[model samples]
Target: MGKLLIQGGIPLEGRVPISGAKNSTLPVMAACFLAQGETILENIPEITDVDVVMEICREMGGEGEWLERGVIRLHVPDTISCKTSYTLAKKLRASNLLLGALLGRFGWAEVALPGGDNIGTRPMDLHIKGLSVLGAELKIEHGYIRGGVAGGKRLKGGKIYLDFPSVGATENIMMAAAMAQGQTIIENCAKEPEIVDLANFLNAMGARIRGAGTDVIRVDGVSELRGTRYTVIPDRIEAGTYMIAAAATHGRVIVENVIPTHLHAITSKLREIGVRVEEGDDQIFVDGAGLFRPVDVKTLPYPGFPTDMQSPLMALLSTVKGISMIVENVYENRLRVVDELQRMGAQIKIEGRTAVIDGVARLSSAQVKASDLRAGAALIIAGLMADGETEVSCLHHVLRGYAHLEEKLTGLGARVRRIS
Candidate 1:
């Protein structure tokens, strides 16, 4: 196992480029199944989830390779087997998305339930409801989600109203509706930029989609899709992470290659905490003085403070002034990192879905473990701000999302070393 030993008190400076959006890449990879020929993708993040998704594609008879530093070539051919093995699907929660793509392509999909972070109970009921409305028969037998088209091998068009603006359900329904026989409308769809990016990429390949970055989405069924080369949108969450890290460490970091508008929620929060934030064309500058004010945060869907960033922001709030209260509205069990942060002498209390954090002057070094991906990143940032050396174990979780994280931190003047 690889672990990161972070030596604290370095102000991270220099320019760092953001990687591709993980949320967009997953659906775009699934979009390969709809292509009649090969699809080439650019700026792919070198995360473990990428490899897992590639394995899923390979199992379904797709070939892929890294064409460049951040480019991938995927060929699904004319036909693909529509089975997602239990072992494969359990690697990540996004694996459930293959069901919609496979069902649209082959009229059947027998996949296992997805597994990822234990933040909360992410239900597939919305996904099933949206697909079932398009004439799919879904059932959970043993541990596998067995589903297929009922009447024919074609998907019938229908309107799907989601109970929540779930990212997964929105992507799943989009994939299923892309190749349907008629028209499909999805109401209250997720309005995240990643979802919109996926829709744009699919539309480039002859899929008809409209109103992506809005609550309402409309799709017209297409007869077939052709190969297309596409570049993924920059990761807002990763950009937000770096911005928070800069704030927590009293560092001045100019993060580049990001959509400044996408970071409105994070940027606003940082400004509220007395951090000097400046935004330019696709870049954001954060200057910190190590002094912070505790603020209230309630995690919500897009345009609201994201739940993925809750842990990292909490780490930043730990060393600030006053008490900070964070209510996790998106995930019930997202406070998995609360215990680990406390190991470093953080004053945080968990009361049900709310986390009450009392500010401390500084954190002392401790050997802590990463509970999940985002939590792992939060701990790394905490370690960077701690008073002494902090060793973070179970680092594989961190690698599932961030690409070359230590290298990026090292570039920003952080004294972090990875060891076996």
Candidate 2:
């Protein structure tokens, strides 16, 4: 059992480096299954999700070990197995990534359904539909998602129009298509940076991937893929959460080792709330300007306001000047964090899917629990803004995505300490 004890009202000031994207590293790790030899992945975040992904690979007859702080060396044998462990598969939602990797390498797969932080119902129907398009036979029995790609079956690539541009579906489809017998075009594909990172990883492995950071992507199937070293992109959600922390606590902080393009949405929204955001080539500086002002925001897909950022943004808005309305377009139950925020005396009301947040002058210290990953981020920001010592439980959810969050906040002069 672990908790974060945060003393509020400190002006967090200093530089904090953002770690590798959990979103990017998980799928990149999954793509190692396509390789026959050793692959080196750099900037791998030391998070719980990565541990789960590593276990998945180890169970699938692959060997992996961390060479450096954020580097992983993995070797998937020439003959890979299609069967995966049910216990490992269900530990992390990203384990479903094995479907495409297994299909690409062995043309078959049998894995359990994914499980992780319970934000909402993240159905895998889109993944199934895209796999079916890539010529896979799938069936749901009991609690497992069983599928095979080689029952005298040919995965001939074709045009796939997704009903929704879900990120997971797009990545899985792209991975499978990269090894198909023909060209594959995915329409309305997810344009998230994580998807682009996955594309870059596949391309590095001798797969032809084009137009990744767009609505449509094209993949030309190759006979085989070779292993190579890849560096994962920095995490934008972690950067956004720290940005909100700086502004909420009336602090000045510089977040480093980030992609400026990936953080455009979060920076734009923060500036709207009177927080000063200065962007450099690989870093961003945020400063609280005297008092914060309220700003209305709506969560959308990539290049728009991201759903992953809504929680931290809500925490910043809790003590701003006026009321702010936020519409969550991505997840159905993302507003569940509002209960934890209310524990700190923040006035917020959830109506259906939208949340109306009334900013108060201050938030009193209170104990709160994290319901999910992003919710943990929101609670941490709330603790940073509270008037006294605030306690946050469920540090496991926070550890899943963030890497050394407490240490970084401490560098920024925040009174944050981890208690186990």
Candidate 3:
């Protein structure tokens, strides 16, 4: 909808607050369907994706509104629609979560195939397999994923083993299994912090779940769930972005409102690169004015280097000395940002899923496009380090994930402004 014009060569120095995790908030909003009453969710980020979820909830006969800044008051009636329209569902990848929540609540659900960033093919097979094991007769009919229990029977709990520990699959199955008739055990589950947040919120709403932060999770089905207030964890992806941005600009920054443990992978990488990283109880300080070294990064499931931070990390590596390699073990097309970075004088070569980057002494300013959410963050970081003004287009993708991006960067003393 707009573009960000940023002047480069200024070291940012200030405090930046991380928002509530978008990954956590979306699934938690879908999980709210299982509870029939007013559920107050605090620490909600004011992002467009939240608006999309609120719209989807209303379309399904649930009512929600912003009670105040960073707060949402949602009320789900006893009876609600079990189908989500393609127009709404296709706007967000997280819409697939409705399949499990609706099926768990009403034994029937019809949701369109999801759409979000076109990084690569993110199959729904894991989600389908996990739900099928729990006794939901799901199938892809026409364009929508539709089906449920055949005989008006509640979903029966069973054991499921995911070949890949997909975060979405883990969350969908967990929500559906929460209302099943017996205990459900999911082995090889994703152990992300967002998964733990979802489990905590569900447990607060009277669902019995344990071992959430581990590879095996146990969910004891409950007859019904009541509404409750819950706060989501801070977004580690956002926190990592700011941390990398500080290092890329040679700025000293303190990122607040974060769980230091959730960012272990990011902090470890920065330290290995010779950046000064100091961790506090709930914050992290990064000093970037030091000699930089090269390091290799490979994306993996939780507790590993997150794919979301891959682009931003590459942006930092582009300015380092020597050669650095990045292997994209998560999404195949996520390296699309390489073309834009190359326009700014970066030397990078892609071989299959791996990127071999040769550090450049400096990057000149150039006009670039943001192909996706994280890619946009990478471009912004590149702009902050370049010699002149840089214009970043495709602003909608950036707005979808980041909240108050220009304001936050400006507060850090960077010259950033939004233009149409």
Best by TM-score: 3
What TM-score do all the candidates reach, one by one? 0.98, 0.98, 0.99
lDDT of 2 by residue, 1-420 (tens): 589999988888889999999999998988888877789999988988888777777877788888989998988887756777888876688988888888877877887888887878899899999888888889888777887875655577988999999999998999988888899999999999999999999999999999999989999999888899999999998998888888888888999999988989888888878889999999999998665677788888888999988988998898887889999988988999999999899999998888999988889999899988999999888888889999999888889899988778888888888898
User: Candidate 1 — which pairs collide?
Assistant: none
* Candidate 1 error regions (>4 Å): none
Model 3 alpha-carbon miss at residue 391, Å: 0.8
* Backbone Cα, N, C clashes tallied per candidate: 0, 0, 0
- lDDT agreement with native, every candidate: 0.90, 0.88, 0.94
User: Could you tell me which 10 consecutive residues in candidate 3 have the lowest summed lDDT?
Assistant: 148-157
40-111 per-residue lDDT for model 1 (tens digits): 899899888988988888887888778888889888876677777789788788898888887887788887
- On the 0 to 100 scale, the lDDT of residue 21 in model 3 is 94
- Candidate structures ordered by TM-score, highest first: 3, 1, 2
Off by over 4 Å in 2: none
TM-score of 3: 0.99
Q: How accurate locally is residue 140 in candidate 2, as Cα lDDT from 0 to 100?
A: 85
Worst 10 residues of 1 by lDDT: 77-86
